[model samples]
Target: MPGSGRLVDVVDTTTRDGNQSLWGATGLTANEILAIAPTMEQVGFHALDFTSSTHMSVSVRFHREDPWELIRLMRAAMPRTLLNFITTGMRFIAWQPCDEEVMRLAFRCVVRNGIRRFQFAEPANDPSALRRVARMAREEGVEEIVVGLTYSISPVHTHAYYAERVAALADCPDIDRFYLKDPGGLLTTDAVRELGPHFAATGRTVELHSHCTIGLAPLAYMEGLKVGFDVLHTAVGPAGNGTSQPTAESTLRNLAAEGYEHDLDPEALGRVSTYFRELVREKRLPPGEPREYDAAYYHHQLPGGMVTTTQRMLEEIRRPELFDAVLAEVVRVRAEMGYPILVTPVSQLVAYQATRNVIDSERWLNVSDETVRYFLGHYGDFAAPPDPDVADRVLSLPKVGKLREAEPIGLEGVRARFGRRISDEELLLRLTMPEEQVDAMRAEPAIAERSVPVDAGDRAPLVRLLREIERRRQISYLRVQKGDDLVVWRRAS
Candidate 1:
């Protein structure tokens, strides 16, 4: 097992994928990432799945941190390894069809800032749309384009179905490799053994990206490796098990026992894991514990990040008990809606409609605007045509007809929507999010990079906590009060 020369590449998705699972969707601020990035750079992984347009929006909208700043910092920290970003076809971060200019500029911005590779996928599996985006991205200096075969179980998504699509993807000129993305961790070991080889047969480098949601990802990964995948996605300690990808430490151990060699340094990766494990403990964040195999996950096919978000949405409506029912409805609705692979946009659309159906007792009564657009073919053609009755019901809504008549925004339209005063990159950000939010982001100064203390809770020093306030002195008086404590301070002009 010392050096069999069957080398594998380990792509880490901790900052992006793990943050989505453990921390909320936009968790893991830039400061937190910078603290551990240098260590991860030394771990010898192939690349880091770092950030995305969704991540950028989340950073500015919720965390008030600059997303570009994150890229710049991470690029400087990990100058040796490649950075991977996720994108949907012709869209930056939103669900609707985005302007062509916005998409082009965003692609260039991502690459210019340091993302050397991109993982592109859309739920509808529109090869032409993917090729279009890839062509533009290639022109804009993106080094590697990784198109994904998003995995799910459905009559329309059989092995034959994927083999044909994989063949088509192989012909895609801009695609450097392919990824079999099982975001839901829904693939069985046997299924992977059958499906994995198809991707490799494409004559392009292929990788397996899956979640540990159903506890079958590791097994599925082994099967994929047996079939000759060139790379596997994994994460470090707190970011790895549970609903996230399998831990790199465990995967390396598995490979060593199987008589294979990988480029990664187990000792360096272990230190990275140690850092995150401590971070999880100090922050009271959930650890990526191995989950028991749950048969229900096959039906829901909800990714790790979505599981928490869906739960929160249910809790907000005071219908937490209906969570299981909602999941079931998702399966039924997905089948009715043509079995689109349950990844983002489609996954979110189906989940929303399912929750509505479960709560309202009247299916499709209050359909979301996005669902109507999906039914009308604004996103793209589905794998299978939608159930006729469901389609009729969706279109019967007052706004669906008008939405269908709308056209995709072009470069000129984008320029008209936002003035030419700002740089193309800034305009792209403004177009991706609400103008008011972008304004707020621009108004806020960049946060100085610093180490994030996980357990600052009540033990944090008052002076250190209120350092921002201390900088403002206009003959000010300050007082703080907690449950059973009070402190006061005054200063003369």
Candidate 2:
């Protein structure tokens, strides 16, 4: 109400975070993304949260598609929109920390491909680490560097704590702006009112990227617009509500209702949404739906994806009943480990340890290698001091000594191992992923030219059948005939 006639910027997260949230990061292929890219460009989005190292790894490991090709194709298809790449600051596809040269090269390769905007978050929220990463991306010629002020609910993460972190980066010339990244969707209306001014004080453009895991992000986003945030991260259609960012269509409408204007074409947005909706239906993928408020989510703070992953892991071990126990242990494990913000790597580490505690008879009896490295300072300084007893127990383990003494391989070393003949894009993939996975990706055939069926009418079922038959190597050909209609597809040798 106070900011009537103000214009807001919208960043589309459908391809990246939304895909990860609703479809487990493997939903859209290069063909699917390319099919809808032209229409997405018609909608005036500030940027497309396009890809990340994790998503790239997902492409090779799951779809056997070259991620570089996806970027190049998408860039060509949507030249007007900025493609964004988000990172964890310290690592690439692998969770382990990499040498500075490796990270620098990774950023260079990313910018070289098509990513113009870079957003990074340091799990520990270390200002120095964030500043260094920002400079690295800048040096690599990234157009915009957005540092993330990762949000969490903990005694140590107060408004003053965040303000101090923001102030620490106030003089960072390499950083173009700051984003309040709430991966857990834990931010509330009250929290926004309290924290907005501190972020605004930085005198830099600030954006808000929050998830709707517990049904609070949309409301928080509305309140955030009233605060200092000007740009909001949203997903398109099937990718937007439950675990992902707020939907772009609803966000734009709400913005208008609240006297703010966004420069997105509703018709274009509708087309993009319809494409994804049909894709979801055809693929039988789960669509993001509105979630009821879950008050208990605040205590554990596991992001939506992690929760689903943990459940699957439990089910895999035939211990689905241990879900509640693992979650409860997550709360305990997080506190003992100094309440690191439940984001990537950290969140994963906490969840892993919690699962182990639930499965084993004793807590901390068996620690993961990553957990050992985390406590050994390989992941940067802890946000807060860990429980003294727990730290002693973790540090005393034999694995900690080896993890502390080991050094991550440098870029040249990686090149030597993988051979310098391969392209930087492939080399980066090999450096972070398993050799067999990369090899399989290389051996796989080119993704088919078939597009997702949007308006196929009765032909949709036939398209689905063809895709299924294509997956089976033993099936050489498929022929379908109904009434006077007949179609035959033969697999290429």
Predictions in order: lDDT: 0.81, 0.87
Number of the predicted model whose TM-score against the real structure is largest:
2
Tens digits of per-residue lDDT for model 1, 173-275: 8889998998888888888888877888878899999899878888888778888688999988888888899989889888888777888877778777876
Report how far residue 283 has shifted in candidate 2, in Å: 1.6
| TM-scores for every predicted model | 0.89, 0.93
**Candidate 1 colliding pairs:** none
lDDT of 2 by residue, 1-493 (tens): 7559888999999999998877778788777777778889999899999998889999999888888878887888889899999998878989888899888988988888888999988898899999889988888899989999899989999878988998899889998889999988999999998888778888998999999988889889889878899899999988999989999988988887898977899988888887788778878888999998998788999986687778878888999999999999999999999889988878989999999998998999999888988888788878789999998999999778788897875676666788879998898888889999999988976554444523322235666688778778999977888999999899998
> Deviation in angstroms for 38 in model 1?
1.1
Q: Report how far residue 80 has shifted in candidate 1, in Å.
A: 1.0
